[model samples]
Target: MSQDGAEFSFKKIAIPAFGPSILFGLGEGAILPVIALSARGLGASVAIAALVVTLIGIGSLLSNIPASILTDKYGERWSIVGAAGLSMVAMILCAVAPNLWVYGLGVLLIGAASAVFNLARQKYLTEAVPIQYRARALSTLGGVMRIGVFIGPFIGALAINFFQLAGAYWVGVVAVVIAGLVALSMPDLVHEGGAQSATGAPTVRSILVDRRRIFLTIGIGVLLVGAVRASRQAVLPLWAEGLGLDASTTSLIYGLSGAVDMLVFYPAGKVMDRRGRAWVAVPSMLLMGISLLLMPLTTGALGLLLVALLIGFGNGIGSGVVMTLGADYSPARGRAQFLGIWRFLADLGSFSGPALLSGLTAVISLAFGVAATGLIGLAAGAVLWYWIPRSPKTPS
Candidate 1:
């Protein structure tokens, strides 16, 4: 088939492939807002509750390489199905937890499952989509996830009214089951005997040796991007509490921001495909950094809303950029292994973000810690500006 024909086929199949991601993201989103609150309700401190949220990142970081191996050997379809089932179990565990420790364990398992699931999808897309259409395809996937997140909190709020915090996990459980069924129903895109890499299968040692420089430089920027994004999620709720906003208000603001993010996904993808990845990357970090810097200055709910708008816009514009960049660097062969390492670094940043914010909060003020993330974002923006072009235009 021609390049255009292949791109068209990939695009057509992409939406179908996104079914599980949307549902999984929705389920996860349903539980995210209340994870900290539930831990606190179970007798944990504020910092400790936040730490529990980081457990997802930690689990993802630890599991990425192994998950990659699974995807590489088993193919993408089964890995996704397994992840969906495991995540459902994790949600059930979270729902039944009597204490913060058990709850953290459940969240950790969900994170591990999510890492495996996400890596499989990323690997599939990198191979499935053509270069010209890659960013758009990924951005659409990212957008769908945002849609799930945007819809989730409201569903969670309704669940909370009926069953409280535990109810949200029930919603997650149902969502995961639906997602798993969707995965089960989809045709096996991998091992359908599509394009196979000429370079042979990817191994960890070979990938590490080959991709070392990209990981050290541009990859670090991707990590920081992940860090900033993760920190925003962690910091915002705490910041809202510090401002004395109620739970409803916090959820409303976040949901609205997510809506804003969803609206921009397609546009962002177009910009990346047409202009360059840096076009979106630098501006995204700069906007997010500015929003974080302004966070400490927000004295009222209205002020916080404005900051959220900026954050939402910033985050929206960068949709799929990290995945796109990772795809750009990933070798055609052993793509899963390379993506495993790539996501590992990104998840490391995700884990570090909350921990770093918590540590800084303990040392200084919450405001200062939030401000520090802004500084990190700004630094990341600079790195992206310098490094993105210098990085490989296509996989080596």
Candidate 2:
């Protein structure tokens, strides 16, 4: 089979690039638990601790458009490599920060760099993967990312235990640098030369007008999914603590669930391609609602772990399946913009999930709030499934 009519092996280019990006994604995922713990150790308030999540979101939101512009100007590979290089710098800044504010600034930079690298690579999705199997390729991308995130935090927990936050930052920096080197080894995307052919490229003016509408539609979807998943992961430890679970227990739960996601991620992507993106999303949505709402009912560790695994499984669909579908639906001219907007909206949910959980914890209880997110996710998924229906990423 061929992608973009170029006879190629999926295992080769996609795997190499996809693998490094996974580390990048993992670093992004691991930051929260370690950093929040760092803040608490330094005597920061819970509100201040929440700032790290906000900074990351602000960084992602602020960077999206600029990152797109950079990708269009410099090409995807160089832009992604540059992003990785910047992330390395961010990790250094984070490692030595004396306070949460400085740490927030460093994380902000990390978010910006991540936004660029993520967009450049995702834009490459439509152009690089065969239309017939784009969902699968997108899923593969998600699977690798899940693996990195799965490893990063568990390793990070070790660093934090032995050496403190500095250790986690050091590891993150090294991993990011390696990711950059890996990205550097990849070829430039095919669109690097004359991607906007004169015949059909959207005029710059028209692009500005229409891209927002598409962004509007997809942004809502991203917000729904990003927030639901982020909140669950971000505050799950807090919930565990409330339930009397120990730190090691929390890590074990997170790790075990991550394993489930890792296992489900690739197969889920393959299913999306074979069965269609909608198939991956619809039932997953139903399950997400059922699983999360049941959080209040779990009687013990086994029940909590099962809920965690269910969340991962649903995410295996939404994060992996639906996100790939978004890559397909986005127009090529402003594909980066679509992604930027989509991710930026998603970041809103990502930021809010933790913050909201913290706030709600004050009023009601963490478990109740957590369950609410599942309801929101179900609502969002239903709207998207009904509205989008069955179709290609672009026109069929």
- Report how far residue 39 has shifted in candidate 1, in Å: 3.9
Off by over 4 Å in 2: 1-6, 29-31, 40-43, 98-100, 157-164, 192-208, 211-213, 216-218, 391-396
Q: What is the lDDT of residue 59 in candidate 1?
A: 84
Clashes of each: 1, 2
lDDT of 2: 0.72
Q: Which stretches of candidate 1 lie over 4 Å from their true place?
A: 1-11, 37-48, 98-102, 190-201, 244-248, 390-392
List, residue by residue over 303-360, the lDDT tens digit for candidate 2: 8899888877777765565457557666656666656666666667777766676677
C-alpha RMSD of each candidate structure in angstroms? 3.1, 3.1
**Model 2 per-residue lDDT at 90:** 88
Q: Which ten residues in a row have the lowest lDDT in candidate 2?
A: 387-396
Global lDDT of model 1: 0.85
Local distance difference test, each candidate: 0.85, 0.72
